[model samples]
Structures are given as C-alpha cells and as structure tokens.
Target chain A: MPSPAGTPDADPVRASAGAPAADRAGGPAGEPLIEVRDLTRVYRRPRTSLTRPGEAVHALKGVSLTVHRGERFGIVGESGSGKSTLLRLLCALDRPTSGSVTFAGREVAGLPERSLRFLRRSLQIVFQDPMSSLDPRMRVRDLVAEPLVALGEPVGDRVAELLDAVGLPASAAERYPHQFSGGQRQRIAIARALAPRPEVLVADEPVSALDVSVRGQILNLLADLADELGLTLVFVSHDLAVVRHLCETVAVVHDGLIVETGPVDDVWEAPGHPYTRALLAAVPTLEGML
Target chain B: MLTVDGLGVRAGDLELVREVSFGIGPGERVGLIGESGSGKSLTALALMGLLPDGVTASGTARLGGRDLVGVPERRLKDLRGRTVSMVFQEPMTALNPLMRVGAQVAEVMTLHGVAAGRARERAAELLGRVRLPDPERIARSYPHQLSGGQRQRVMLAIALANEPDLLICDEPTTALDVTVQKQMLELIAEVAPALLFITHDLAVVASLCERVLVMYGGRVVESGPLREVFKHPRHRYTEGLLAASRLPPRGTRLATIPGSVPAAGRFPGGCVFRDRCAHATETCETAPELTAPELTAPDLTGPEPRGDGHAFACWHPRR
Candidate 1:
C-alpha cells in the first residue's frame, strides 16, 4: 500500500517537527492543509408566546483539528453529535460563533462572500442525498458543467472526462437525473464535484442513502479518486466500517465534542473513549458468524 | 406460529412477490434479507394483508388457524393488532404526531376490548419493558418530544402492547445509529415471541436470526439455517450479497455485483439473477425450482452426501 507522504500520528504535537515549512499559507509536508482551532457554534431558539426566554443550544464546542494535504480524514458521529455542524464550518457554508478555521493558510470563518471565490474553488462538497442534491430537470452534462461555468472556467470536454472517470458512460450526459438509479445518480453527483478539480473534497454520508450492494463500488471509487488526484478528503459519516475502510485517520464526535481521534485501525482495535467503545460495540459484523 | 406457502402477490399482470414460502415457529426469529426492490417489504405487507388496493394475493398464509391471504377486511382488521403486529422503519412517521405516546399504546389494547383504565396501566408497563426511562413522562410526551431512540422504543412498546403471537419488524433499526440500534435489537428480541425481521443488512440478520430467507427480483432465492447459508451460500445472488457486505483489506478493490436489481416487472423470464451471474449459462434459460444440491465432504475423493434441507432456486448451485 502506498501511504501518503508524511502521514501524521494522532498526536499533532509530535507532527510539528517533520511538518514542512509554511511556504504558501497551507504549505507542503509537515504543515497542515486545514487547521481548526477552538471552533464553536451555538444556536438560540426564538422566543415564542408560550415561553418567555429562549434557550441556547450548543451545536459544537471547542473543537480543534488539522487535516494534512492528501490525507483521508473522517469524522464519525451519530445524529445531534455536531458532525454535520463541523462539516458545514469546514466548508465555509456556515460561520462559527467563535474560533477560527484556517484553510490553505487563510482564515475561512466569517470570510466575506466576495473573498470566498478561492475557497470555493479549492473545497467542494458532495451531499448525502444525490436525488435532492442534483437538479431533477437539468441534464447530466449541464449539471457537471455548472461548477466550472460558475467559476468562469472553460467547460470544453471536461464533463465527458469526469463522467468517464466516475465510471459513467459519456452518453449519460444527455439524460435527466431522474432516469438513473440511486447509485448512478450518486456517481453523477461525484462527477459534478470533481469537475472543478478541487484540492479538497468533503462528502457527508455519501453512501448511506445507497443500497449495500452498490455502496462498495462508490466507496472504492471515492478512495481511488482521492488517491489518484492526491485530494485532501474529509468524509463525515455515522458508519464506522466505511470510515475504517477508506480513511487513515478518524475523529469520533459525541454530544457536540470530539471524544476521540486516532488512526483508524488503532481506534477500531482499541477505542479510547466510552462513546467510541459503545459505538464500536453497536456495529453488527459477520466476522465470527460468517 | 406462522406458515406462508406458495404465497404470491400480483397487480394485474405484474408479479410483486412470486411463489414465496416460509415458516416461523412459535418463539422463532426468522429473517428476510434482500437489497432494494427485492420484494422484502412487499412480502411483509402481503403477510399483514396490507397490500395496497388493486394488488391481489394468492396461495395460503396460515397464522395459527386464520388465513391471512384474501381474508375479509373486518376479520383482518381485528386480527392485525391482536394477533400479528408490525414495527416499521421510521418511528416518527409510523407514530401519530398529534397523539401522546402513552395513549397510542393504550389504544391498541383498548381496541382489543381491554378495559380503558387497565389498558393505560399496561401501556406504561410495556414502555418500561422496552427500557424507556420515566415511562410515565414518556407516555405523556408526544412523538416529537422524544428522541429518535426513544420514539423507536415507543414503537416497539406499541407493537408488543397486545402480546401478539408474531411481530414483524421491517428495518426497525435502519434509521437509528449503531448504539441505539443495538439497544433496539436487544429490546425487540426480549419482548417479541416470534419475529420476522426484514432488512438488507446481512450482518444484522446473522446477529438476530437463526434462519434466513434471501430474496431477489421478487422471489425467494435461498432459504435455510442462517449459519448454514452464510457459511456456504448456494445461490449466486446470495454469494454476491455476502461478498459485497464485507469490506476488503484497505487499498483493495471491493468485490461488487456489477448490475443493480432489476426494476419491478422487468425481471428476466428464466433466472432473474442471470444478468448479473458470472456463472450463468444457457441452462439458466429454464426456470429452476428451489432444490438442495448434494455436498461432498472435502476430505474424501468420493462424494459424501449431506443431509437434506436448505434450498436455493438456481440451475448451477455451489455445493
């Protein structure tokens, strides 16, 4: 197996020494590609006639992490664990209440919309539901070309290549999104995400909506694409098996906080936190039974 | 006890579930495993006589002495909650948002002629049995007030409120996280007498059921002891499904079944799985009935026959 160059251990402190000198804000080896420090997001419920005072809900609390270039990082958590909130913050889709998210050596949190063009080109997201994400009325060709068209980049034959890369035929470009199955639609969504040739790809529960038989194919495709493109992939899911299969490092989130972070194998073999242990125990496996 | 034999469900000329057969003994846990569009849910709806209008069912489905197929609506309505209860995938959708959890549980008993006052008390007890904390508070709360895990427990509590002979849970834990799912599975196992657990997850089926029936293209492709089928899957589709479930070692290509499940009514005339089967030959053109092929012990050169049981509908089965 060809591991990424300069893969770090769970301990970021130890990784400081070998980290490449910061050449461009987010530099090469040694320096992290993405750094999040003390990130927190709190949502306040609106006061209603029945209730005088509104309550504050902490969606995320003091979360800190670093994603090295070309590394597959995974965030695993159940509903209400703030995994989704964290992803939104990382992608700059939503700003945090406090703390900082530095991407490519530039702060992303609270960044102005006009200045976000660079971040937009660098980071791309593939949502959970392909059916909802892809425009039903749009042709596959136009859907794949939308990112490039928005960025003012040329869309000559790029859509065709992307479809081929994701294993979809070139002819699929002419068809509407509704004509394809769930897995095929996801492939189209993936192809669209890759059209911009982004450096970082963030996928939230990409395969959870797919059938078991086709889930493997999509996972393999994502892993292969990330490696082939040397893209820094940040994948968020509740399924530990999928994370273990595709990720080198994993962070387990619980109750709006990261409970544990470590190498995928290490965490799976001996989880450090109580929540991690409980989550692992819940996964049904055929190891002994089969 | 439930015995479903040669049960087929169809709409006009289209067959949704064809020649399906299975038996769930008293207190037994049987699983129906299949991927999307495999007719697993349709078969469950057929068992409950819940197939939508315009669709008709054939063959015999005997639940104790009652016939579920083509039964009168009035009789089926009485037997539904009192005899066989079902827990669905989405708890929130399955429950009434306007109704309190406690009242919903109590309603099942009250409809069966239990005293109104006694039904409320029993509902609380059932909630407690399903491990929902603060049964009294939960009973008063609406479905939206509780968490996903709590709502699922309430669904289980309602399903078991009548102490039905059989319980059919269709992907009950699929919507839940791993930890909550484990708890729900344990509770379901503890409370239900006989369970017909339906899911696309093979590992979950292996964990909960001793016997399993593998469905594909609206047909029961394989049926037998869970361990026996898992160890040596005879049908090509079952083998593909099992192989797909397990992730290969890191950085390796996963073994995937090439094509997706055929759309409804578009299944090939002969072998429904022939399109995806690597070993399919001309012989597969003729439809094959469920049969148990002889297995030879590996140690001996001569064929050592195995006992009869486990069956697969395939022309070329792996022995």
Candidate 2:
C-alpha cells in the first residue's frame, strides 16, 4: 500500500508483490527506491579446537521489504535482531549470504568496485556514536570535505554551505570534533553524510548517544532536512516513540525477521503481532504519564 | 529515612552542584531528573560519600539521625553498605569479571562482617529474591556469561544484599533494552525500601518514582509529587523538557529548549536557566528562591487532597 496520511509523496505500488516491479511501474510513481528480497546473512565463527567444528549465527533470516522513494521507513528491533545486518546489506557495504538488494532498480549485490562507487555516493550512513565514527584529530572542515574530495568533486564553498545547513556556525569548520559537544559532533557527522548529496540516508540510532535536550535538536534537523530535500530515509532504532514520530511506515524486527510492517499509526494504535504489541507496551510515553 | 539540606559539591574553584535539598521518606521513591552535566549523578555520589578526589561537598545530609556529608571516611565506610548503598549504570563494569556471580553477592555480605558460612547461603537467596530463575546456576556463572538483564539482576542482588536503609541507583537501566529495562525497573521498585533513582529518561522516572526533582545547571529547578509535577509543571525548564520528550504526530516539529545545558560553574550568576527560558524577565537577573506557591492548607476532606507540596525555583513560572 502507499504510505498513508503524512507521507503523501510515497509512490504507489502493489503492497505485497513478491517480484521486482521496477519495469512494471517504470516512473518514480510506482518504482521503489530500495528493495530487499529474502535477504540473509550468516556469520561463522572459526573452530578454536580441532574437536569442535564451528559455530554459525543466522543474523538475518531472509528478511524482505521495500522502501519507496521519499518515504521515511523505519526498522525497529532490540539488540541483535539483525537490523544492523540488514542495513549493511541494503547499503551494499556488506554482501548478503543469499538474496537480492536492489537500489534504484539496479542490483546491489556483487556489484563491481567501480559501479559500487555510485552506490556509495547515492546512499550515505550516519552511525550511532559520533566520537568513534569521526576522526579526533581532523578539523571539521576536512571531515565534511572528505566525501566530496574522495569523489573528485570541487570543494568550493560547499563546506560552508553544509555547515550552515546543519545549523552549525561557519567558524565551527576550523575546530576539531573533540572541541564540540556530543550534539554538535553529531551535527558535523550529519553534515559530512550530506556532503555527497545522497538521495537516501540511513541512520542507525542517530540520537541514542545524545542527551535528552539535544535529542530533539538532532531529530528535528533530520526531519527538516528529509522534508526539504525530499530525501528517502531509513531510520533504524529500538525506540518505538522515536520511530513513530519520524517514520511513515515501520517494520518491527524480531528474531532476525520482520514480524510486522504497516503504517506507523496503525501498528502503534493496533498492533497485530505479539512482539510489536510487547514493544509498544514497553515504551513509556508522556501520554502514559498523564 | 534520609534528609538533605543545602547540599553543594565543588571542585577547587568550580561548583558542580548547588543548593540541592530533598528527602526520601521511608518506603518512598524519589527521582532526580536532568540531562548530562546536570549534576544528578554527582548529587547521588555525594549522598553516598563516594565523590572522587578534589571534589568537596558542603551541606548537611543526614540518614536516620547520622550525618552523611562531612563525616570521616572511616565512619562513612561503616555506614555505607549497611545504611546506604548504590547501584551504578554500567552493570558489566560494576561487576567483577573474575568472580562468579554468587561470590560477588556474598562478598558484600562478608565484607559487612556476616558469617562466612551464612554469606554464601544468603547470596543465593538474594539472587532468587531478584527473580532470577535457577539462582544456583546463575551464581556459578561469571559476569560475562550472563546476559545484560541477568547481570543487572546480579547488581541488584549485590546492592540489596545488606538491606541498606537507602538505595541509590544512578541510571541503572540506561544500558538495558526496553523490555529488559521495564523488568529491571519493576524489580528495583519491588525490592528497594527507599529508592533515590537518578536518570535522564523522564518516562522511566514517571513510571518508577512517586516524587520528582528536576535539575538543571547544577541546581534543583522543581520538586513535587510525580503526578503533580508531571501534570502541571511550574518551571519553564520542566515544561520544555516534558514537551521535548513527547512524540508529536508526523511532520510536527518537536518543542526544543532554546540552548543546551550550560557547563558546570559556567551558568549565569543569577538564574542558571534564564539563558534558555523564554519566560525570563528583568526579575530573573537575580536568582529566584525555590518556593511552593501552590501549597496552602490541605483539603483533608477532599477525595484527592491538595496542598502546597510543589516547589519550583523560577521567578516567572508557568501559570
């Protein structure tokens, strides 16, 4: 189904069509920006002793979902539910053990390094912890400029514009990330991610490491940017309220599988799956306090 | 019961916590809420006489007629595990990786001079009390062998082993998943006689505590019963925080406080929160006293009694 209510720009397509519909619905109106079909990832731990063979972990158990262009899609799960694994595969950063991931109607799996460069430019990621992701010694200007510089794009005035767009001062570009607070450091990360001018942004618990007061600022910045640029967004978080606030459609991951998927309000107001109901109940909200 | 008055913590020339005063009645649960650098944790540390070097606490904090602040370290040691105990946020670090879970819980009892033989048996019982299934097996496992929830339960068992009159938890569930956090919160409430919970999650506080204290810029900005403070927050900072925590409908902008929390000792000399508070006026140039304006005589006859139990430290509080 098309994204209901707020996300009016969501391209319409068959809700549960098993096969790729890119050619069937050629225009952006029906073509999904990102699609995953039966994606699976298996990690094998080497045998430490000769007597033991090895250990195998099925991180993702054949998960499938489609994210339409300009749609704010969310994946919610507790730790080790394969949300991270799915995100890595969807971004083409890691190969799936089996299944297919298509970005803009092109297969993401087994792409050549040269073709993969295009995927890197089109899809960007903002990690959870900014301190670890950002280089401590590098100045903010060089960090935001790294993406453009690597892509061989001109660096003229783009850094200043990016800093301004992310609500950071122009002078901030000269300071190291260590000089900034957690919130400011995250803003810098967001600016860096946007430097490539990507169509899709995937954030994995972007605000979880931030303080309560600063969480709003970062989430608002992301929401504002997503709307202004019409960017397709994939937000992965365990926070039900946060996912409900930011996304139009949500897929609840449990036991390495998508247990439920629907409009955010539909799932929140009337969850059909047991795990989704439990997750929604566990999240304490301001309305509950009242 | 515990009572604190005019508690302040300072490091050399910098004051990190100022004029914090609250009490935990017997069997009562009180929450100290704020963002990072707001001194909520420091306040708990000061209560337990566990401040790091170079930090000095000034003010009177008495537990059951005995002074906690300014007490000699020797005397504080005697009262620590027996009178007041604390559970830190990180369960993995809080536990000793080298020791088995039972040994760790029994260690607290043995350190307090419980009979060695009795301590071992009591340790297993304490683990069972925290609702861990098959406490005997869990007691034999190492800290790393247990899941995050199981490790936290061990922490709770250790904290409650001596049955201290007061239990101080500093962001105890911040590291756990939502489902695990819910169970942990419930277990703490069930076991602790008097809890002083410090956390940044307002919803967690609302669910767990009966009373609330809002802190900002090293000061207590508001204090009241949980229902009263949450339903009708007087301080502008509390109002902003409550609004910021809510999940607005899709496409709505979250209401954010104007600026980030000020650095410790860097707050304005007058009102610490005035820089971010939109209600600030000329009068706010001077620090406002924390007073309970709504508190009058209680309506004992009414079904839900009303009294002047709420206090806020804002010159221009919300009506």
Candidate 3:
C-alpha cells in the first residue's frame, strides 16, 4: 500500500521497504511527538443502594510514555491490561481522571472541545472492530470520504485516489461493506484513516479479527503504509508475534501497569521482567519465540 | 472413556457437523484446533445436546460407558453440570448481569442439590482456589464488578463447582490476555480433569494438551499426540493451520490457506479439503475413509503401530 497524495520524495521511502526499517528514517531519538505522563482512568462499579462503591477499578495505572516522531511503536498486553484504556484516553474518547498529554509539544489533555477536533485530524485512530466501526448502510467510498465531509475540506474528487492507496480498486467506492470480506473491510478502514493524511496512526488490534490465512497480508499492508507515509504508528495488540514483526520499540503492560519498555529485539531475546517472560513463553509457537 | 461414533449434525438442509468421532481416555486433555465456522465449537455444543431447534443429530455418544446421544432431555440435564461441566468462550456473557457473582456460582451447586447457604461457602472456596484476591469481597460483587480475567476465574469456579469427571473448555482463554491465559492453562493442567480444550490458538494446544483433535469443515481431519502432530500433520488442512500460525519454529512464513472453511450443509461429496488441498486429485472426489496413515511412520509408532494412539482420515498423507 502506498501513501496518499504523494510528494516527490515518496519513492525513496517506498524503496527502503527491503532495507532495515530502523535506519529507513534515520535515528528516532529526536523530540518526542507524543508524550503521555501519569495518565489514569477509573470506573465506578454498579450499585443498587445509595451506599457508595468500594475502591474504583483502575483501568489505567499511571501509564506514561514518550513516542518519537515517525517511530513505529507498539503496546503489547492481554485483555484488561490498560492498553485499550490508554488508546481511548489518547483518542480523547474518554477523559483521564488524572495526568497530562502533550502532542507535538501541545497539551492535548487540556485542549478545549473546538481545538480537540483539530487535534483529531493530526492523530487518527483505527479501532479493533471494523465491522461495527463502518456503517453497514454506507458504501466504501462514502465511508472513506466521511472525514473530508466532516471537516468540510475540498477533497471531493480525491476519494477514488485514497481508496487505491489502500490496494482497493476505484470501483470499490460504490459497493457496500456486506459485499466485501473481513480483510477488505479493514483495508477500507485503513483507507478512511489515511484520507486525512494524519501524521500518527493508532491501530487497535487491526489484524486480530481477520482470519489467520489473511492476517499476514494485512500486517504487511500496515507496515508498508507506515514506511511509505512516514507515519508514526502505534499498533495495539495482544499478539506478541504480530507486534514483533511490525514494531521497532515495544511496551508491555499487565494489570494496568507498564511493566517494561525496550527495543523489540532486546525484550524478545531476554525479557527483563518475569511477567514479560511469561508473556513470551505464553505465545503458542510451532517451535519457540521470534 | 468418551467415544463419539459417526456423529453428524444437520440444520434445515445444511450439515453443520459431519460424521465427527473421537475418544478421550480417562484423565485425557485433548485440544481441538480449528478456525472459526470449521464446526469446532458447534461440535462441542452438539456433544452437549445444546444445538439450536431444527437441528438434528445422528450417531451415538457414549460417556464413561453410558449413551449420551439418545439420552433423554432429563437425563442430559442431570448429567450436564453434575457429571460433565463446560466453561464457555466469553465469561462476561456466560455470567448473569443481575445476580451477585457468588450467587451465580453457588446456583450451579444448588441446582445439583447442594443446600442453599452451603453453596456460597463452596463458591468462595472455589474462588480462592482459583487464586482470586480477597474472595469474600469479590463474592459480594456482581458480574459487571469484576475485570475480564477475574470474571473468567469466576466462570471456571462455576464450571468446576461439582468437580465433574469431564470438563469441556470451549476456547476458555480466548478472552484472556496472555499472562492470565498461561495462569489459566496452568490451573487446568493442575486440575488435570478429562479436558476437551477447544481452541484455534495452536500454541496453547501444543503446550497444554497431550493429545490433539484437529477439525476442519465440521469434521475431524487429524488426531494425534501434540508434539508428534505438530512436526508431522498428515492432512493438508492441519498443515495449513500450523503454517498460518506465526508461533513456533520461526523462519516459516505462515502458509496462507488460500480459502476459508467451506459452508456446512452443502459441502461437496469430494474430499472436504480438496478445494484448498495442493495435492488434490481425482481420488479426492470420493471422501477418503478414516485411515491409520500416521500409525505406519517408523518414528511415529513404538513397538506396535496400533498401540501409539493416533489416527488420521486422509487420502494423501504429507511426505
């Protein structure tokens, strides 16, 4: 998959797909594009009487991270490990009870409602459930073009071009989602997320729902998109193999805590924490670890 | 021993499951592996006689030397949780939203004739046994109050309430994160019940189960020991699943199966995997009879071929 609205320098980035990814865009140790500090979200348990609930559920336990610009970073964890909470908080769909977020040196945590919309454009999100995320009634092209319409941007005629960037034919614009397969729908979702030309793309379990037969292709597509677009990718998945195959740097979470953070190769080779080691050991392999 | 002989499930004109059969020795842990709609879960449901209305099943299922296929509804109901219990895929949906977690668990024992107040104590003990923190505090909470992992522990507590001889786990750890999933597997291994652990995740099956039953298109494609089957899967479908999985033996790019499991009911009379099988030939036009191809391997068998406990139904065995 190629990046949309390509500039003259796109060919070089695309050519580097066969080369080492870490050196593709030079070193990533510059100023961080996304900085999260002590972010936490809590939910109260349901109760019948006026009696207050006990200690609140700690969906997020002080998660803080610095994501460098153009770095393909990954957050790996199992269910209820605060990965989803961190994603939601970053997307601004849910408010953090405590903590701050600085996006491009701008404090996103305190961004007003009107400014949040503008911020949303620079930070795009692709959710786990593509079936539910895309409207069944709407055709592919219309769904891809929704962001453009929402922002009242003048990309009216560029919709077809966006669809092709995600490896879909221009003709797919007219067909409804029911006509396409699971992997096809995810391709459309990726196209929609790319329609705005966002700098950072956060895909939450993007390939988790697809069949195993088609998962590798989707992973390759996402990786290709990240490389070509020079996009800072934050891939959230419980799958260690997929994360290992994609991301350069990784963060491991357990029970709402950031257990460990390191290079993907280092952690995979010799996990520092016992939880990470167990997590590594837990990955079902025909042989062993990646 | 549980023996399923020529079990088939038909709904309307569609055959959801076709002539599925397997045997689980006492204290056996058999992992059933397959992709979605391949009839793995449906097979489990059919075993429990929990198929939807209009679905008809044929053949006989004998559980511990007793017939389960034609057993009356009353007898099956009595046997379901008492003699044979199951842990479903989703813990949240399996639990009742309106009831307290403890009461829901206790309800299982109570239904099987445990006293009213006694069940709660039993429930708390099971919860503690599963390593839940602060069992008393958690017992008072509702299903919605607990986390996904905690709720899963509750489901296990409920299923094991009676200490049934046979415990059927249908993708029990699919909803759990990796660490919790390992812990859950360790718990199941410790219990060492006659387990039928159904899952698509091959790694969990490989590490946890001693034997495996690989399913495809609502049929048992391959059955054998875990490590042995992994190294040499006789059927092409089994090879495809193993290849598709990224875990295990790195350097192997997941061999895409090219197509999904065919829809049930109207499958071709030819070999079930013929459409996707690379070795498909005219002989596959007729469904191959279940054979002992795996039994003939020099390294596969010990002293005698028939005694090693593995069987595969395929015309063309992998080299």
Candidate 4:
C-alpha cells in the first residue's frame, strides 16, 4: 500500500539504489553507521543477607556486531536473553562494563549527556508498548513535536506531515492518546520517533503488543518509512518470522551471547545453532500443516 | 460434550457478545479465534458460569446435557472443576502466590470430592504427567520461585487434577516463550480429552485444532474444518485474517485490514466486520445469516464430525 500522503519529497536521504542491492546480495557494502565491539554489561542483584555482597549477573558478554547505514538489522531472542541489554548499549542508553561502541568512527561508550546531542539526533527508539511510551497527558500534535522541540528545531508543519506519512488524519492531532485505538496509538508513536528525522530507527518488540491484524499495518508502515527515508533500522523481536519479514541480516542471541548471525534467509533455511533450530521449529506456522 | 447456542453476554443495556453458537464432541479439539474485544474469552467464561459481576449470560449452553446459563452458583461451583475446567492466559496470576504449587493442585482435587490423602498423591502424578522436571521438588516450591513455564505447567496440573470432560484454554501460551509454549501445547493435547482453545494466533490454532470458529464483535462469523477454513476462507474477515497472518516477502508490504477492532459494545448493528471490510455493500448493513455455502470442491469434514457444514456469515464472499 502506498503511504497515505503523496511521495515524501521533502527528505533528500532516499536509499541509494546500490545499498539495497548490496544488502540483498548477503552483506551491506555501505559505511558502518554503528560499530560495537566485545560489549559486556553486568548487573548486581539485590542482597538478601546482611553484610553480604549482592550476586553479579552478566547480562551481556563480549557481544559485537556492526550496523551498516541504510541496512535493516534484526536481533531475535526470547525474554531475558540479553537482547535488551545489547539494544541499550547500542543506543548508548546504558553503559557497558567493557568494550566500546563507536558511531561513525567516534566513541560513545561513556560520553556525558550534554556531549551526545549529535547521537541523540541521529537515533530514535520506538518501545514495545505505545500506551506506556507515549505520554498520556499530551495531545497528539505536541507529542509528535516533542522530539523536534527538545532538539531546538522549528516545529513547522512537520507534525501534519508525519501524521500523513503514518496514515493518520490531521484531526487526530487534537485528541489525547487514550482516544486512539491501539494501532493508531502505535502510529502516533512512530510519527513521534520520525519527527526529528533520525538516521537510525530502533524498534524493540514494536508490534508485540498490537493485535494480529494491526501488526501487518505497523510492519508495512515501518518498512515503507525506512525505505523512503533511507534510515538504518535496528529491529529487535522474539519472533523470527516478523524479523525475517522486515530485515535482511539476523542475529540470534541466547543467554547473553550471539549464537548465530548471518543473512536472515540463510539462517531461516538452515540454522547452525541448536538453539536457533529449536526456536525455528517451535514457531507454530500454517504452512502445509493446515 | 459441549454445545452453545445463541450465547450472548451483556452488561446493563449493552451486549458485548451476540449469537455465538458452536459445539465440541467427546475427544474433539476446537479453536475459537478472535482479536481483542471479540468476546472469545467471555464465551468461555460463560460456559463455566464464571462471568464477572455486573455481566450476565443469555441463551442455552449445554455442557453434558446441563444448561450452564442461569445455573445456581452452588451447583455451578460443584460442576466447574469436575465437569469443565479452564486455564487462563497468565499462569502467575491464575495460581496462588501464598500457596505451594503442589497444594494448589491438590486443592482442586479435594474440592471436587477426592480424598485429601489420595488427592495429594495424584497431584504429584499430575505434575509428572505434564512433564515438569523433578515433580516432587517442584511441588514444594511457591509460585514466585518457579519460572513462567513451570508455573504454567503447575496450572495445567491443577486443571487436569479432577480429569474434567472438557478443557477451556484462553490464550494459555500467549505469555510464554516459543519453546516452552510448544511443550505446553503438546502436554495439553496429550492430556485434554476435549478442548475449546481460545487464542488470537491463527497459526497456533492451526497446529493443534481440527475445527475452527472465527469470532468477530462477539459473534462466530465462520466455522468449519481447520484445513477448509484456512485454505478456502469465505468470510471477508477470515480471509483478511489469514492473509495478515502469513509473512510477506522481505521488503514487501503485508496485506492489512483497513481498520482496528471496535471497542466492546461499539460494533455496528448488522455486520460486525463490515466497517473494516473492503467489499461491504448496502446489503451488508443488514445482518447476514450463517449458512453453509455450496462448494465446487469436495467437503473435507473433520474426523469427529459435529454435522455442521462449512458455514460463513457474509453478504458478499470470496469465491
């Protein structure tokens, strides 16, 4: 389906034809937008006894990967698999205990908040639950424009433009978040993320909370927007099928480590890791079995 | 073993579910598929006479020749665990945090008239039947100490303690990981004599069920053998749902339904799905009856034939 608005002509960062061709051929040839190396994060559990140290939990262990510009990279893992920890480190939301994360050849491992304005403008995240992520007290227009306002950018007609791009009516801007349906609320969340025109879009289980029918709408919207803007997508989900639909590269994380990484189709056709095989076999599919 | 006809649930003047009818024979496995606000869970709750306060049920729901609607609470309580048991979506909430897992399973049996000593012994056996590792050790652990899958297994053990004739599972595996969910589904299929599986996942239903009922706006808009419905869906809603469930080619757009599900009690008067269906006409403003359509292909009836043919409710249907 075409985007609700006419073709987005305002943005000049459309995908270069060679980028997707290279991605389809197995690997991305574009420059690395984000590079991670030997990343590890450890957390201390709460102490249960007096005068005793809390147990140390290794959430991530020596994980390393590269996300190329204009590439769709998927991270698949179950809950508590340290996939969230990896995403947090990639986005610089959490500090890693070891290793380094570099964005466009600059280290972002432990930078202060004030010095990370460029990183903030280059990446945006859409969380799992739209209801929890979007502020309930704000109107749709202000919520969509909040990112731009925070970055000291002029809030022009970008709100209406984004609403159209995500297939929402202009009338929706006047209403509160509670007035919209779950899918509409998600569209609002996507619009809010795109307001500042970030080069990289990170979605964490974005459609997991939506209904079965509406999930396709959101996925299609994400794919369409990513292509139109040439934005690098770092999508994380537990379902391989969903990731396969949107991403070219896949990384299967299990127990704080990357168990498998390759082209999504190759991994889906023949998984090397036993955990990936088990995960693939367990996903209920309506293939010939129906 | 279970037959529901004209089942409707209402709170005050608003009807949330309307004209839901289906049946499950002995040893038959059926799936009730719907999105949120589709009234699938309410229908299961109505079957067990376990609807919440301010909500009441209508019409006849015969469970083993006994009407469940309007049944006395005392009698319903007696029939619940013994005749028909239910497993909810969240095992953590369904289980008692204060009680040990073994005691919870044993309590269901003792409440259904099994002796306390014999019930305790059977509870462990039931846990083992569900394939929970170290059943004896698991029995002594509280709900908080167990993982989500283990807790779900404990819930299954309790549901099967009295060996009910029919089991109603409402999204029992929705909150679980894929591997754990597969094991749980296998365990349920092995132990449940008859099942009314309710879930939004069409693939999960296609994997475990022989017959399927598609519910929309609290109504069973379509019903038939799983293979027939999945392959040749006549209802617009079912066709859209199946298309949406399939993964599209990478980088291509997925087929999507036009609108979101309406809020409970806010669905239109006639066709519940017409608002979202693209082929809706003025005739769709009037409700269509559920009827078996003439098929050019051979009818693929389910193994435990309930006698109902492939049926759909639509003024205009895909050929």
What DockQ do the predictions score, one after another? 0.44, 0.41, 0.26, 0.41
Report lDDT per candidate.
Answer: 0.85, 0.85, 0.78, 0.87
TM-score of each: 0.92, 0.93, 0.84, 0.93
Docking category for candidate 4?
acceptable
Q: Rank the candidates by TM-score, best first.
A: 2, 4, 1, 3
The reply for model 1, stretches above 4 Å from the true place, is A1-30, A48-53, B292-308
Report residue B267 deviation for candidate 3 (angstroms).
5.2
Candidate 3 CAPRI category: acceptable
- Judge candidate 1 against the unseen true structure and give its global Cα lDDT, from 0 to 1: 0.85
Question: Residues B1-319, candidate 2, lDDT per residue (tens digit)?
Answer: 5888899999999999999888788898999999998999999999999999999999999999999999899999888888899999999999999999999999999888999889999999999999988999999999998888888899989999999999999999888878778888889999998999999999999999988999998899998888889999999999999989887888888888877876777788778898888888889989988884354236423221221278899888888
DockQ of 1: 0.44
Model 1, B264-306: lDDT tens digits are 9988888999988999999998888877433333432322111
- Please provide, for model 3 over B142-218, each residue's C-alpha lDDT reduced to its tens digit, 9 standing for 90 to 100: 98878777888898888889988888899888877665677788888777479899998887888788888888778
Best candidate according to DockQ: 1
The sequence of per-residue lDDT tens digits that candidate 4 reaches over residues B1-319 is: 6878789999999898888877899998999998988999999999989899999999988888877898899889988988899999999899989999999999999888889999989998999998887899999999998888888889888888888889999999999888778888888888998999999999999989988999999888889878888999999999999999999779678998988999987788789898999999999999998885334345535442333467899999888
lDDT of 1 by residue, A29-128 (tens): 5358899887889987887657576778888877888888888889998888789999999999899999899998999999888899999999999999
lDDT (Cα, 0-100) at A259 in candidate 3: 69
Alpha-carbon interface RMSD for all candidates, in angstroms: 7.3, 6.6, 9.2, 9.1
Q: Alpha carbon lDDT of residue B167, candidate 1?
A: 97
